[model samples]
Target: MTRPRYGDLYFGLSDSRNEANQDRDSFLQTYVDLNGSTKRVVRGDKFLVLGPKGTGKSALAWYLQFAEPEGAHLALVRDASSLPLAEVPRLQTGQEPGPERTVVAWKFILLCNYLELLMRDQGCSINRNPEVVRVARLLRDFGFMGDASGRALLKFSTTTVTIPVPKLGTIYKRESSSALNIFNLIPYLEMWVAEAESAVRHILLIDGLDSIFLNDAKYDESLSSLVQAAYTLNQKLMENRATGSVVLLLRNDIFSRIALSLPDSQKMRDDLALELDWRVLSGKAGVGAPLMRLVNTKAGRALGVDNFEVLKYFPDSIEVGSRELGVRKIPTFQYLLNMTRHTPRDMLRLFEEIRRVEASGIFEESGDRLRQEVIHEGVLQYSTKYFVGAISNEFAGYAGGPERAAAALTALKAINKQSFDGDEFRESLASVASGIEVDHRDLLRLLFYAGAIGNSIGGYREKSYMQFYHRRDESEIYLQGNFMLHNALIHAWGLRRTLGNEPESQTGAIPLIDRGAARPRRRRRKWEERKK
Candidate 1:
C-alpha cells in the first residue's frame, strides 16, 4: 500500500517531527533571526526557553533540529522526574535524593551523548564496537529504543570513527564518571564528539522539563539532582569552548521551584535561563520571532498557505489599540485581506483546528457553504473556550470560586486590556483574589499563558488585548504582572447582591468600608438637596 500524502496527515507538529521530512515546509524556519537585540539565540546554544505554557518553545527546537543548521544538535531531554522506574533504577532506591538524582541525570545525558554519537554518520561506523553493543542493548531493553516490555541494552561505551588518522583506528573512549558530580566528563564528551567530526555540533534539548515532579517520596531528591546537573552543565559551558548546546523547554513555575532549591541565589540566574518573560519588550518578542519562524514553515508547507512560506518570512506583527479611544490607522495594500490577530501558537493552533474541523466530517463536505460555516463556527468556538479558559483563574480569584469564573468569558472575544502595572493601583484590588496563593511575576502571567489576554498595545506585533500577544503596547496603563483577579469581580458582587445573597452592609446601598463615619450630613440640608 502507498504511504499517506503529507497533506493527508494531522497538523500536530509536536512529537510528529519525524513526519517533517515529508512536508519539508513544516520546519518552522521563519523565526530564526533575532530582533533588534544582539543576543546569540540561534539553535545549539546553552540558552533557556522560559515562558508560560504554549509559547511554542518546543516547536522551535524541533524546527532547528530539522533545519540542521551549523553547530546545531539538539537532545530534547525530559526531566529526570519524568523518567520511569523502569528507565532509571536510582529513582526507586531510597537514598540521598539530591546526589542520586544528579547522578542519574548525568547518566541521562550520557545516554544522549551516546545516542547523538550513534546517530551521526561517523557513529554508525563503530556499530560493531563492544561499548556500543552494551549501551544499545540497555536502551532497547529499557524501551527507550525498543518496543513495549523493554528487555535490551546497548554496549557502546564510547566510539568515534572518521576517515582521518587516530579516529578510524582508535575509538573515543567513553568514561563512566557522572559529570553532574565530577563536572569534567561533559568536556570529554564534547571532545569525543569533535573527534568524530569536528564540523558537527550536537544540540541537547530537554523539553517537558516540568514533567519531573518532586514530592516527599524522595524528599525532592529527583529535583535537586536535576538542578545540580543543570548547574554543572552551565558552569562547564561557561568555562569551556562550545562544541554544541543544551536547551531545556521548561515552565516558569518549575524554574521558580528550582530557584528556591539552589544553595547560592546567584547560581540560579547563572544556571537558569528563560526564553519567555512577563517583563519588558525583552520577554515575548525575543522568543516570538524564532517561534513564528517555525509556524510559518509548518503552515505554508503543510497547509499550502502562501503568506509565510519559509521559516524566516513569518514576520511578527502585534495588534495595538487605544482602549478609551480609536484611530484611523490605515495602510495601503493591493490585496484584499481579512484582518485578524494571532501569536505564534495561535497561528499553529488555528491551522490544527482548521484541519481537524474539516476532517471531522461534522458537516457535509459538499461545497464552500459548509466550509465557510465551519470556519465561522471554528473561530467562535475556539475564541469562547480560549477566553473563558484563560480568564477563569483570574475570574475565580475575583469572584472567589470557579462557578462565577465561568461567566468572565465572552464568545469569540479579542484581547483589549489597555495596560499592565505591577505597582500603583494595587489598592483597588478586591478581596476576591485575596484568598488565593500563587507565584510572583505570574499575576499577569495566568492570563497571558492561557492565551486569553494580551498587551492591548506594543512589540514585534500587536493584537487585541484579550488575545495573547507576542509584544506589548508602550502607551497603556500599568497593572501588576502578579496573579490578579480581573476587574469583573465588582459585577459579580453586584449580581450576587441583587440575588439577595450579598451582605447588606456592603451592597450598593452602603459602602463596603466607610471612613470617618463621625462626619454627618445636616437633615435640613440633605432634605433640601433631595427635593431639589
Candidate 2:
C-alpha cells in the first residue's frame, strides 16, 4: 500500500493587518468575535481600544471598518500619528490651560473632520450650516489637509480670528477674539447637528499608531494630542447623547506611557478601554483559549473543517517522552505555543514556516506528523530568524538604530547557552563580539520585551515569561539571577535545552546570526541630511 501523503494545510495564516488589506473574505472568515468587542464598538459604548503589539488591536479596528452595521457610518483615520492637531483652534480661558486647550482642540478637530468626511461622502454642502462653514473655512485656510501654514499653526501659542455671521447675529469682539476658540462656537455646532438627520450614527476609527512615538518627543506629543482628541470627542457625544463615536486604537506600551500624564486617562480606561490581552491569568498554561480560538478560526475556514476540530489537521505531538530522540507524541499546537510569545502572529508565523518546510521537501514525508528534525530545526529557525529580524527593524529608528538591538540578539545567539545564571548572562553580554556599548541592564530589558528571554522566580514555569517586568512599577527588567532562552528560539539560536537542569547533548545545528552593522538605515533622516 502507498504511504498516505500530507496535504497542504497552511491557508492564509498571518497577522490580521495583512489579512485585512490583502484578503477580505478570508480575513472575515477567520475573524473571531473577541468577547463582544465588535458589538460594544458598534453600539458606541467603547472608544479606546488598547493592547500590546500583536494582540489583534488593528484586526479589530479593520474588522469594524469593513463590517459597518445597519445605521452606522465608519470613517477611518488611517494614520493618527500624523493628525493635523495644529489646525484646530485651542480654548484659551484662564481655567482651561494648555493641556485643557489641547483636549478641546482635539474634540474640535474630530468633529470637523468627521463632518467634512460625512459631507464629502453624501455630496452635501455645509453652506446652510453657519458654524460648519466657519470651521471649514478656517481649516482650509490653515491648510488642514497638509498646508505649510498648518505647521505654522502648530507653533502658535495663541490664535486670534474674527468671524461675522449676520444671520445668527453672532459677532466676536475684535479685542476679545485674539484666539479662535472652537468651544465658544460649540453651542451653534450642537444646534446644527441636533437639527440635522439625527438617526445616522457616525463612527471614526483612528488606527496605524504602532511604532509612532518610539523615542521622539514630537511624535510623542502628537500621539498625546490624538488621545486627548478622542477623549474630548467622547465627552461631547455623551453630553449631548449624540449619534457619533470616535475610537482610538493604540498599543498598550504607548498608552501606558502616556496615560499617567493625561488628566482624564483614568476615566477613559475605566469607562472605554478594551485591552486585547491574549494570555490567560495562569502563568503555567502554554496558550490561552482566545489565541487558540483565533488559530482555529483561520485553520478551520481555510481547510474547510470545523473550527473546534482544528487539532485534527496538526500532528499529535512533537515528542513522546524524556528520552533522547523521543518519538513525536506531544501535540504540535501546544509545542508551537510553548515557544511563542503568546501571540496570534507568532502562532500563525510558526505554522507558515511549518508549511514552507513541508513544501521545501527538506525532510522525507512520514505520514502526517512532522519529523523531529523538521519540527526542531526548520520551524524553530524560521520563527526565531524572522522574529529577530523584526526586532532589529523595530529598533532601527532609535539612536544606535538596528545595531543597538541586533547586537544584543546576536550576542545571545553566539553564546549558544539555553539557560544561564545572572553572572554568566551578564558576562556573556559584556563579552559579545560587537564593540557597541549597550547597557547590560537595557540589553536584558530589550530581550525581555522582545520575548527572547524569560525569568525564573521559584514557581513560574515559562522559560520566556518575564513576570519580573510586569511586577515592576515601571515595566523594567528585574532579573532574578537566573534566566532561560525561549525553548523555541533555543534551537534556532544554537543553544542547548535542559532536561532536569542538565544540558541535552544532542542540540540541533546552529544557524548564523545577523550582526546588524551592515544593514542600511531606513528611518527618516534630518532635513539637512536629507538635502544631501
Candidate 3:
C-alpha cells in the first residue's frame, strides 16, 4: 500500500547479453515484448532478427531460447563468440575460401549440432536404433561428445573416417588416395535428423555476431554465408516435415552490406527478416509506448506491484523551447526520450544514471519521488559517459574510426553553435583535422550516418523540417542545406543555441524543471475505488 523508494526499484541491466548469461531469471522477469517477435520465432515464421545496436536483438534471442512457453520444444542458444569463426574458411569443402565454401561449412556444422541434440533426446537411444549408435559414434569421434569448442571440432574435419549405411555400402570409404571429409556427411546427417522424429520442435538461436565482426571482406562473406545456410536449412526442415528451425541475430548495418550481394536479397528482406525497431511517431510515445512500457514492467516486477505507474517517480513535466516550436511544456518521460534513439538499453541506462545521482545525494528526493534536478543531472552524465562511448564503439571497426568520431565531436564543440551551414561545418572540422585520415566529406557522411548531425529538409520558414538518420531513412546530408546537431549530443558537446552568428532570445537558458514543486495527490483508479 506504500510507494517504493527509487533506490529499491530495479531498472534492469544495461547489457542484455550479460543479463541473459549471468541472471536469466531476472532478465526474463523484466523483458518487454514490443511486437509479436517471440510468437513468430516459435512458430517458425521468421528466422532472421536484425536491428541496430541496443535494440534488444540479443534479448529477444535469449527469450526465445530460454522461455518456457506452452509447447513441446528443444532450444539451443549458441554464442558466436565461442565458435571458431576465423577458422571456418580452412575447413575443406572442395572450393575456394569464399562465401560459397563458407556456406557449405556452416551447413555441415549446423547439421552436426542438430544431430547431437537429436541423439541426446530421450526418445532416441542407441540400443533401439542402429542409426543412433552410428550417429553417436560419429559425434564422439569428432570430439563433439564432450566439452569441445568449435575450434576443437573443426580440427577433426581433415581426419579420414568411414560411415556405413544400412543395406547400402559405406558412404565415405576411408582411403589414402581418395578420402571424404566432413562435407560428405551432411546428407547422412540430414537423413538421421529427418528419420528420428519426435513431437518436440528444435530451435537454434545464434547471437554475438556483432562482437566478432571486423568490417572486412572475410567477415562479410562469412556472415553472409551463415545467413544463407540458415535459410536453406530452415527450408529443408520444412520440406522434410521435420519440426526444427534456425534463427540468426545480426546488426542492421552488417546485414545491409551483406544483403547487397545476396542473390535472394529481396526475399530475405521481405519474407524472413524481423526488424527490432522501437522508434515511434513523433510526440506519440507518452505512457504506453514500447520503450515506456518496458520501464514500467521492470519497475513493477522489482517493486512487487501490479500496473505500476513509473511517472509517479519523477516530476510531471519540463519546459523546453526551440526556434521551430517556441517554449512549450513537455512530459518528463518525453523529455528524457528525446535524448535517446528509442532503444530499451538507452532508456535503462538513463534510469541507471538517475539512480546513481539520487544515491549521491546531490539532489534531495521528495516523498519517494526523484526531484527534477536529479533527472537533469542524470541526462548530462548519461550524455557524456554512455552516449559518446556508444558512438565511438559503433564505428570501432573502421580504420581510425573512433579517433575520427572523437575529432568530429571536438570540432563541433569548438564551433559552439547548434546549427551551421556547409561552409562553416567544413571550416570547423578543418581546424581539428590534423592527424585524422578521413576527408571532410567523408567526415560529414560519417557524422550523418552516426546520427550525430542531420540535414534540414525544408525552407527557412517551414517548421519541424529537421530530420536525423535514426528517425528517417531518407534523411541525407546536403552540402548546400543547413545542418542541425542532434538533440542527444547537444549537451554532451556543449554547443550554443545560435544560427550562424545570430543568437536566439533564450540563448544559454536552461529549461525550468520544478525542483521544489509539491508532489501531486495520488488518485486511485476506478477498480481500486470500487474494491474499497
Candidate 4:
C-alpha cells in the first residue's frame, strides 16, 4: 500500500470546531485544554464551564463525554435546542418552587438521564428497573422518550421555565394536599448509585445549555433552576459518594444572564464555575500564548507528528514591503493571533482554512519531509477571509439569528473604516439602509461581543482593551470608548490598523486592502467624452 502525502493527510481537518461530528477519535486526537484547568474542573463532581461562543464549550463537552478521565463513565447530552423542558413543574402550590424545588427538578431531570444510561449499560431492559422506569415514564409524560438513550435526552430540555411562573402563587393552595412522591426522583437515583458504586462512577455532561438558557425573560426562571441544581446536586453527590457528577457546559454570556437573579450567583461564579477563557494574558504578555500552544497541537496532528512547535510548519517571521518602502519582519504566530479574537476554535478554523487553501497546490510544496512545508501568504489571506465570514456566523445566533447579523456585517464592510468615534460610527451606520435595524450603540455592543471589534480606551499611552465579555456586569462600558475593528478583519473589511501612538483620525489614512477595494472607474472613450 502507498503512503499518503502531506497534502492528502490534511483532509482530516474539521472546518468548524463544533460537536456536530461526535467521532471520539476526531475529538481525542487534536483536543487541547489551554492550561489543563478546564480538564481538572470537568473531572470534579460539579461545575460549569463558561465561555463565549466558539471558545470550545461544546468541544470540551464532547471531550468529557467521549474522552472522559479514568474511573468515570461520561454520558453526553446534546441537541438541547429541541429539549422538551417546558412541562417540568415550575409551580408547587400557588407559589413557584423556591430555589430548592427548582433545584429538585434539575436533579430529577439529571437522574433520569443517569438512570437511562445505567439501564442501557446493564443490557437489562429499561422496563426491568422500576425506579428508572418510573422516572422515565414521568419524563415521557412531559413529552420525552422514556426508553431513549441518555444522549437523546438532550432534545427535551430546550425552553426554560418562565419567570414569575404563572399560577405559582395561585395553584399551590388547591394542590396543597398533594403527595410529592412522584416528584422525588433523587431517592431512586441515590439507591441506584449505591448499587453501582462498585462498578464505575457516572457523570452526566449537559451541553448546549447556551441555547436552552437564552437570555430572554422566559428562560430566567429555568436557568436559575439549573444554577441551583449544580449547587444542590454537587452537594448531594459529594455527601453520598455513590452518585457521580453533573457538569453543565455553557457560554459565559448565558451564565451571566442566569446568575443575575440567582441567589447563589456569587457562589456559582466565584466558586463552582470554571471559566473557559482564551484571553488570559500571562506575565506581561498581552497575547494568549496558550492559544498558540493549542494551535501547535492541532498543527502537529495535521502533520502526523508529536512535535507541536508551530514555527516548524510556518516561518517565524514574514517580511513585507519592498526595499524602497522599508521592508519589516513580523512574528508569524503573533500576526495570526492578532488577527483573531483569541479563541481556540477561531484558531482551529483559521488553521483548517490554511490547510484547505494549501491543498489547492497554489503554493510551492515541500518534499517527503512534512515539517518542511510552508504556509504561504496566499494561504494566510484566504484563511483570514474565511475566518471573517465564520465570525459573523459564530455570533449570528447571539445577535438573535443569522439574517440580521449577516446584514450588520454587510453594512459594516461597506462603511469601510477601521477606527471610529461614537458620533462618527453612528453617522456611518445611518448610511447603510440594509441589515438589522439596531441603533449604532447596540450594534457596536453586538460587534464588540462578537469579537468583530475591540474597545480602545485611555488612548495610546495607557491603551486598555475591552471586549464584550470583559466587565460583563458593567453595562456602562459599552458607550465609553473609541472603537477599533480587529486587525484580522483588516483585509476582509478593506481597512487598515495603525499601531502605536497614532491618533484615531490619522489611523484611517493607512492603505486599504487592494483586493477588497472598490473597482476603479473606466476612462471614457474620446467620442463618448465629447457627448459629456
For each candidate, the alpha-carbon lDDT, in order, equals 0.37, 0.57, 0.67, 0.53
Candidate 2 ranges with C-alpha deviation above 4 Å: 1-15, 69-71, 83-98, 120-134, 145-198, 213-225, 281-288, 303-308, 320-331, 360-374, 393-397, 421-430, 433-437, 460-476, 498-532
**lDDT tens digits, residues 1-532, model 1?**
3323222433454333444555545444333322411123343333566654545555556666666543334333343333442233233222343465444434444444445444554534334455444544544544444223212212111111111112221233443322112123234334433333333455556565433322233434444455555556545544555445455565554555555565753555454454453222212233333444544454444454544432121122212223544322211100001111223444354445444565677865524222444543444444444423434543332323353333223211111222334432232222233344433234344344333333332111231112232222211222333221222221222211121222222222222111001112233236547778
The 10 consecutive residues of candidate 2 with the worst lDDT sum are 510-519
Q: What TM-score fits each model?
A: 0.47, 0.75, 0.80, 0.73
Model 4 quality (TM-score): 0.73
lDDT of 4: 0.53
Candidate 3 structure quality by residue, lDDT tens digits, 47-131: 8888766888888877766674544676777777677676676666655556677888888777767666666566643235664
Query: Which window of ten consecutive residues has the lowest lDDT sum in model 4?
Result: 510-519
lDDT of 1: 0.37
Candidate order by decreasing TM-score: 3, 2, 4, 1
TM-score of model number 2: 0.75
RMSD of 4: 12.2
